[model samples]
Target: MTRGTGRGGSSAAARSVDVARLAGVSQKTVSRVFNDEPYVSSDVRRRVLEAAGQLGYRRNNAARALASGRTRSIGVVTLGTALYGPASLLMGVERIVRDTGYALRVVNTMEGDAAGVAGAVGSLLDQGVDGIVISEPIDEAGDGVDAPLRVDVPVLVIGAPSPVTAPTVLTAGDGADLMARAATEHLLALGHATVHHLAGPQGWYAARDRLEGWRATLTAHGRDVPPVVTGDWSAASGYRAGRELAADPDVTAVFAANDDMAIGLIRALAEAGRRVPQDVSVVGFDDVPVAAYVTPPLTTVRQLFDAVAQEGLKRLVHTIENPDADPLPSSGPPVDLVIRASTAPPPSRTTPARGRRPASPSPADTPRPPLTNGGPAGDH
Candidate 1:
């Protein structure tokens, strides 16, 4: 084997020919093994991998790209936020893409950035990505329909409608509405006359879906659809909305868009002398880590971030590998609603809803109780 020395006299980097020679295979067989092309026997493939491992050999992705005209990398356009939902989805995508043997390139776009998905996609295209994943959480549709983005590669858009016109476009994780519907339905099934809604900001497509699901559930059940209380997906906003809802005697149940808001709403209700599952019942979306540990363990719907990423990437990779084949079908995200102590049937008797009553104290100040009436621990 020909070997060269570096400045410090270290041996040259191990190449495919070295791996092939050690494995007793031709250089072409080594290429097939590394490229994951099918015709070789399982035993030969394993031997090639072992030889490469022993020699510390790494495949030259750049050289392969030059020969095949494919970068074997996937690009992701995600919202530049630390919020749990978007961040979790992006992490899931990264994990799955790595496992699929494709390098991942991520570009984050802020909510108010002028160069939005279009600019992000342009950057990925410049880098020669085989496919792209749009994990944007913003409602980019605006007042009018946005002109479809130009992309030559296959694309997978999660949780929202695709804004790009591409050779192959796939979608997954659009089950937020169904999960919200489950939350609302749970409240209704508990014999609450009407369930109030604490919606997320209208600027997000996720928030819109949750709001719509709440409204639709109320309408279907012939219950009065009260005015929606909007929040910015923050605990502070939920507290503000809770203060308003506390003043109304009719709000015996509330369906919050997320767990953070729901926790804040619960605190506000406590301060107003409204006891959870006693004077009021609450259901929240996103079974966050703190959901089960809060004063009154929060009942919530879980978002299937990993599941969405797996299904979406599977379809996207299939499309990239077989250009003429139809995209793989997607099984929608599961609707997992965790039932905890925060939700219950309404109070048997009428009680004052407005000011703090001396008899009733805030749950936040009280000692934490054991969680009961809880469901399975779904994905965080």
Candidate 2:
């Protein structure tokens, strides 16, 4: 019957009223802090938490659920993969959710899992989460399945379109296209006549977005859009594409869908005696940790996983708290193009033809200022 006992029903545990008394605040304020309700000042919240910690007080989530009809927990549906992008995003979500005072329940769906997103949602619903976050969902049906997915809780889909027909479908962190555009544009700005693309598999929405952005950039700039070479978001796939590309002298610059592919492409190019930034330039997405320490250093678009997760979760929590209000408008993720030593102006074209030309000066040969076009830059 006592608060802060959760479902244990302990009579001796410290209650919210005790915390409020110790923190020199009203019991109402203590409830607001524990419930994660908005409008509580940071100082008051901190004081209440300190008092609760001192007294070893905890929230009676079961009682609170009965009173407010909310479990105060969130469910996350993500692809069960070790890929850098998805894994990093899930970690960010985990970190931010803890700060929101909501218990997290994650359900990962594998590549061939039956019902994929729908099944994941059903499982989470059964567990009774207040909200759901679908992070980086791949296109399961490939050709766009027409069936609508049903979900009752507030849904936040990140980095992909919402597959569900929930009452509150909030979408955020779908800026891969914009970042891809920036990467492609960066190579083009460096004087490559037309940049080649090493695209990821089309199944992933992120990959499709990157491919779309690359194609759109070339089209908008009036450059020749080369035929796309698809990779499997792996170094080996990139190496294969690179081997094919290396045979053609026309491949001056390549915008890979991800950093691993770009690194593999560079290795393949090196084996073929095609010097990077001298004979060819390369740009990639997701500036991974080792991007800077590679042989030539990779120029890449930095994906802000933490920032995206933080922003998206904030909006999700807001929707959970205020059911009637419209979902907040996203200001869009910040685009960061990290300039390293791997990109440079194309080699000189003596004959003005599409054949193999002499190697030009590398981008590192001259001291150039940090270059940025569409968005922010993190020059190395």
Candidate 3:
């Protein structure tokens, strides 16, 4: 066997030939084993792997790609934020891509416009990605945006419903429609006369879906739909909305678009002398890690990000392998409503005294007690 003469005269970078010689098998067998191609006997595959490990042999992906005319890498275009939803989706995609023996290249686009998406896609194509995943497409109107949809490779868009030039997958089930209904219904069932919404910023598909769901549910139940208080998915925005809602003695139940805003709302309500669950019940979407640890563990809608990622990755891979296959619309995993200390029945009275502490409820009229700290009620 020939030894590599580069750097300290150490032959640590062994080639497939070296593994083949050591295992008494052909180099093609070693290649097949490393590539995970079928038709090689199990015993031979084991021998090749063991020999490669012993010889410190690594497969040359560059050479393989050159021969195959394809790069085993996928590109991901995502927003440039550390927010939980986008971050979780990226992590999920990364896990699946790594497991499937493909490397992931991520590009963060600050803008959510057509030019921004086009630039990101152009960069990925320049880098020779086999396929692309638009992890989060920004469609503020609930209606799909006309961003550059022209791509030669298979593309999977996460969280887009319309303008289906390519296969799309939503990270949350039924967009925000399912979650809003679940949260609104929960509060209504708890005997709240009406539910108010702390909505995400206008133009966000999520915000639009959630607002529509809330309005639809309220209308369906023959209740009046209150005006939405808009937020930028920030705690500060939620606090501002909370202050506005707190001033109105009639606001008893509030569903914030996300947990961050819900936390802010809680703080604002507390400052305004309105006790959560006792005076005004609050619900949030996205059961983030801190949801359960908050003072009054949050009642929220849980989105299965990992499951959505898995399904999206599966479809993208299938498309990449079978380019001629017809594209199909994909739905995301179901959402669950997690009840905690943050939500309860409305106070017995119609309206509380504005800017004054609400009266304590009598024992018989008390709503269900808050769950124990750090313990969440079972998923609905």
Candidate 4:
């Protein structure tokens, strides 16, 4: 037999004709199955799919786009870093986009500021994507020179709401302010007179939101808000901030913006001979995979990234299909606070005199009960 005449072979490449012939159906039926058009019976759809698989048939996306006058693809712009938040958001977008039978093209800003973001979006436009999603746009350099992105295509932003005219979606339900408030209040509820914050870098919208949340909670409760120590969302930065906090005897409780920084802060406290939940307590944001398995399980706020991605994708697709309809801003997904072993009431005694070391707490003084699953001890 000739090469093209074999059981699953074709003259050139497998096409709808081959699928239809092998499945004993008309070419139109095969087309309906591939296009997901209604009216194809279940048995015929299953037969067409099975035959396509057997014949190694792949849909001609380019041809479909040309005929339909639409590119079934989306462009995603995000930060270059592999930080958990950005990475997770990208994964979620990819999954949802694929489920909806669209292709995803991604561009990274390579740690640049607003200019980099503008460039990334421009590149996606050149590639002819149906829609664009900007994940975690940062204003690090703070040079307001970059103009707002102007695009004819639908645009969705995944970070904090911006001045850009595009409809924005927050990945977290409560935004940073509420999350920070929740974390700080958790520490205060444990009887810590005040809460110190180790914030994320200034450029990140997430960082700023968290700081705002922490400050607002402190102010509302009439608690002292210490000077903010900023970190690049890295454990090393947290360690550095922790070392400085370790020196101050007045430091009783700390809230790091992410779990990596929290881990670093805990290590620094340990090195300085301060026991967690004894001499000091630490809480972190982002309940990362290792948060629960750490030496002292982290008390953290968990944002539902998958839910955010799904909701954002749904909204973007709706906008793409109904261009004339007004796009409603989404409030995003809510966050949960998971109370673990890493926090407790402040030391029983007042802050020791500046230079004098505080007495170590006895076992009785540090009563660490089993960690609670998902609620704060009380309203701050």
| Model 4 alpha-carbon miss at residue 8, Å | 6.8
> Each candidate: RMSD to true structure?
5.9, 4.7, 5.4, 5.9
The CA lDDT of each predicted structure is 0.85, 0.86, 0.78, 0.79
**Which number leads on TM-score?**
2
lDDT of 1: 0.85
What TM-score does each of the candidates earn? 0.86, 0.88, 0.81, 0.81
Give the lDDT ranking, best first: 2, 1, 4, 3
Inter-residue clash pairs, candidate 1? none
C-alpha lDDT of residue 269 in model 4: 94
Off by over 4 Å in 2: 1-12, 36-43, 349-380
Q: For every model in order, what is the number of clashing pairs?
A: 0, 0, 2, 2
Where does candidate 2 have its weakest 10-residue lDDT segment? 369-378
lDDT of 2 by residue, 108-192 (tens): 9989654788888999999999999998467877777658689999999998888888879988788788888888888776778
Instruction: Flag the better candidate by TM-score, 1 or 4.
Output: 1
User: For residue 336, what is the lDDT in candidate 3?
Assistant: 74
Task: Give the higher-TM-score candidate: 2 or 4.
Answer: 2
Tens digits of per-residue lDDT for model 1, 1-380: 44534336589988888788889999999999877888999999999999887777888888888887899999999999988899888999999998888999999998886458899999999999999999988876564376788899999999888889998899998978888888888877667888999999898989999999889988999999999899999999999999999999888999999998999999999999988978899988878888888878888887878888998999999999889997788885687777877876667433445694634424442222232134543323
| lDDT score of residue 55 within candidate 2 | 71
Clashes of 4: 2
